[model samples]
Target: MRTFFNIAAFAAGSQALITRGDSCCFHLTASGGASGSVGQLSDGQNRIGDNSLSPAEFCINSGAITDGNGRGCILTPPTTQLQCDEGATPTGGFSIDSSGKLEFQGSSKFIACETGQNGGLNIYTTESSALSNCKPIELMADSCAAPKPQPTSTSTSTAVATSASTASATATAPATPPANNGCPTTLTSGNFEFPHLIVPIDSSSPDTAAGTQFNGKVTSTVSSIFNFDIPQSDSGKTCSLVFLFPKQADLQTSSFTFSGDGKIDFAALSGIATKSTTFHNAPSVSKDLGTIAVSPGNQYVVSTFSCPAGQTVSYEMKNAGSTSLEFFEDFNPSP
Candidate 1:
């Protein structure tokens, strides 16, 4: 059937015609920039508006129609070709490539899917396979749900037996040895120092032999032993000293001994001595502090010693290794 109508007779912005069709197509044309060729189509109980102004443009506005069944329009692609904006070459916005990939052109173009409930949008492939085979790029907020844990059955007697076995095993285990009560684990460059030959004794009288005496000098009349210089107030308190060598020094195959006539003994010292490279411009000879030999290694040699109250002690290096020895004292004694 063919019908013709002059849209100028209708009021401006008015609904000019209404048609009911199951399978029909309408071609609209307008001239002189006229804007009154608006009409409505009835597809069953749904009313679809046809607001066409030019040959290349048409729009459907359903604001005047209401349906509780949530009806919508579907545009099926004929021969797998779909285009927007009169099939014009899109400078930006949405497009589908020949590979069937939906692409958004331009930097600011985006597609936003809004959901009103906790559910999120899901995308799947057209392949006929299990859902697990299709991996989705999840970008939704809090969309993943954790699987619930299943319960297992256990008997009271079995649980009690297992608890008893664990307790018995724990009780039969051997006790662990105590941790090493030693000097600080980390040593810095500042911890090294040139060995001091003599330090003033902590005494009331400078000439007192009791606390201000030194052993016989190794080369000179004046003893050249490395003095610890324990304060008179700190007498009788235990202390520790750590001897360290530079990285260039080898610690293996080196030996050191501490010997002096200050009533001190090697029973308080503990460390390994190792061979090391000779230091440049090192002193030709080093004095002795004690009589006992100490093994040398890369590790620091720790010595725990104490001087009797109102008495003084002197310490000297008897065996200077390949490298010059540097000594540091732990003024803060370990408990």
Candidate 2:
């Protein structure tokens, strides 16, 4: 029942892409070389502009369906034209039902956008989302495949009153700086939160030191590591490095993490759910710096952002569900 996905008008006056308004579009099956839908530049080589119009916004990924820029439409190897690829893990990730019915990891295949092989309009899912020339693209045209919201700091929303648990206490104090209290740039919710000790990143990447903090988890993956500091009076004010999942469905990627040692389920299955972190490094594994997307009407999220205050903020963090990530720094506020 959600359908206005114009996706920022497919942008074409200057360039650069991503303008954003919670947009969505992905309709493609045209033949004149383009035009049924597609717009966040899906890497198949870019060509979407018969006047563009709209369409190209899908983001449900725990394995892949990505296209609001996270890419992944991949299911290739059969005809070879389907490849939007950014972090492609596809084989699963598309499911949609409450009676809306969309399937891909639910497996009868079905994504089909059509035209392929270089003739243009490419994208497919095979076994039929009704291919022939391809054109089955419907999820109400598009409005909910999410994934994009990780910056928090306009006073952190300023109204959380309660609900917390990393030893709970929910401390609050820092938020007076958009020129010393005129505030409202957005981040305020930091009734203060604490609980430390995290060391698991034995170098699959991020920086090269994991000799202590007691030396645990890094058995080969599920990365972790910690270090925090940022008080010069919070210098210019935007501080967020949060994580606390006791259940907003434990923020998802679910196999029941936190206790269920199933390897990497730190809540790992909602659109492939997130747990990627990397700050202060310099190379190409990418999370850019930190990635946080855990929502069940909000489960105290926000996993990265710092300001000019002082310094020392290292987090190597990895992915999967529940391995312990309760942090608060000039942070808090999300009941």
lDDT by residue for model 2 over 98-127, one digit each (tens)?
233343323223333434444334445444
lDDT of the candidates, in the order given:
0.20, 0.32
* Per-residue accuracy of model 1 over 1-335 as CA lDDT, tens digit each: 00000001111122111111111122222112121222222331111122321222222111011112223222112111112222222111121222222222101111212122222211211212222222222111111111111122321110000000000000000012211111121121111222222222212232422222222122111222332323344433333333332232432232223233212111221221111111221123322212211223322222333423333233433222222222222221111
Candidate 2, position 148, lDDT: 24
CA shift at 283, candidate 1, in angstroms? 21
Q: Which stretches of candidate 2 lie over 4 Å from their true place?
A: 1-34, 38-88, 91-118, 121-141, 145-189, 203-222, 225-316, 319-335
Which stretches of candidate 1 lie above 4 Å from their native place?
1-181, 185-224, 249-297, 307-311, 320-335
Lowest lDDT block of 10, candidate 2? 1-10
Model 1 worst lDDT window (10 residues): 164-173
lDDT at residue 224 of model 1 (Cα atoms):
22
Cα deviation in Å at residue 57, candidate 1?
A: 99
Models 1 onward score TM values of 0.20, 0.26
User: In model 2, what is the error at residue 171, expressed in angstroms?
Assistant: 16
